[model samples]
Target: MENYKIPGHLRLETRRWAKKILEEYTLESHHFRMLVKTCEAWDRSEQAREALAADGLTVVDRYGTPKAHPCVGIERDSRTAFFRGLRELALDVDAPEVPRPPRTRDYGSRR
Candidate 1:
C-alpha cells in the first residue's frame, strides 16, 4: 500500500477530515492531488466562514450602501470547489458497503 502524508498546513478540522478520507480510501496519485486541493478548499471556506462570523455578513461601502462581505463570496466559491472535488473523487461509489437509508425515510411503507 502506498503511504500518503496529510499536508501539515491544513486547519485542524480540515486535517482531521483529510486524515479520515485517506484512511478510508486507497487513492491514486491523481486522486491524492485532488484530495489535497479539496482539503485546501475546505480550509479556505472555513477561514472565510470565520471571517464572516467575526465581521458582519454585510459591509458598508464608501457610498454607504451595504454589500455582502467579500468573505461571503470566498466561502461560497471555496465550498463549491470542495463539493466538486468530492464529486470527482466519487468516494461514495468506493465505500466497502452500501450506506443505510436516512432515519427520516419510511422503511415500513412502500411508496
Candidate 2:
C-alpha cells in the first residue's frame, strides 16, 4: 500500500531469492502492469547509458549496435528493481525441506 518506489541500485542479495518470492505472491492486474513498466524503463536506461560509455574495443554487431552479453540479464537495473518489488509485495513462505541421508561410520574394517 505504499507509493510507487524504485530502488536506486540492484540488490545483489535479493537476486536468487526474488524468483522464489515472486512465485508465492500474485499481484493484481494494476500493480503488475506498473511493475512491468518500471522494469522496462530501467532496462532501457541501463543499456543506453552503458552502451554509450563503452570503449572502442567493446564488441558490436554488423549493424553497430552493442553485442548482447550474458551478464546483462544478471546485472540489469530492471532486474534489481523487479527483485525489490518482489520482496516488498510478495508473500514469504518457508520451503518444505527434504531430509538428508545420515552419515554412517564403519566400525569393522577388514584386517
Candidate 3:
C-alpha cells in the first residue's frame, strides 16, 4: 500500500525489505504492526553484527577474562525476534512443522 510508509528510522536495506513486503502482502493493521517490529529487530540484529565484527566476538571483563561480546547475545536474540515476527506475520516461505512426541510403549499396562 502506497499509503503505508516505512519508518524513516529503519536502515536502508530494512526499509526496502519492509516496502517490498508491504507491497506484496495484503496485511491487516495488526500485521502492519508486526511488520514494523520485525523490521526493527532486523535492524537491531544488523547493528549488533556490525559492532561485533568491528570489536571482535569477545571482550575483556573487569577481571581480565575474555568473555562473549554482549552484542553476540543481542544479535542472536534480535535475529530470533525477527524470525519469530516473520512467522507471526505469515511471511516465512515455509511453515515450520510442529514437532510431535514419539509414541511410547506401555510396558506397565498388563494385557
TM-score of each: 0.80, 0.31, 0.80
**Residue 46, candidate 2: C-alpha displacement in angstroms:** 1.4
Tens digit of per-residue lDDT, candidate 3, span 1-111: 337778999999999999899888888887888999999999999999999999999999999999999999999999999989987887755565875456569755847
Q: Better model by lDDT, 1 or 3? A: 1
- Among all windows of ten consecutive residues in candidate 1, which has the lowest summed lDDT? 94-103
lDDT of 1 by residue, 1-111 (tens): 579888899988888988899898889989999999999999999999999999989999999999999999999999999999998898987554867567666676867
Root-mean-square deviation of each candidate, in angstroms? 7.0, 13.0, 6.4
Expressed as tens digits, the lDDT of each residue in 1-111 for candidate 2 is 323333435343333333333455555656645555545545555565575456332467789987755445434665577567645443454443865456567535634
Query: Which pairs, if any, clash in model 2?
Result: none
Rank candidates by TM-score, best first: 3, 1, 2
> Any idea what lDDT model 3 has?
0.89
Error of 2 at 76 (Å): 14
Residue-level error in angstroms, candidate 1, position 32: 0.5
| lDDT (Cα atoms) of all candidates against the true structure | 0.91, 0.50, 0.89
lDDT of 2: 0.50
TM-score, candidate number 3: 0.80
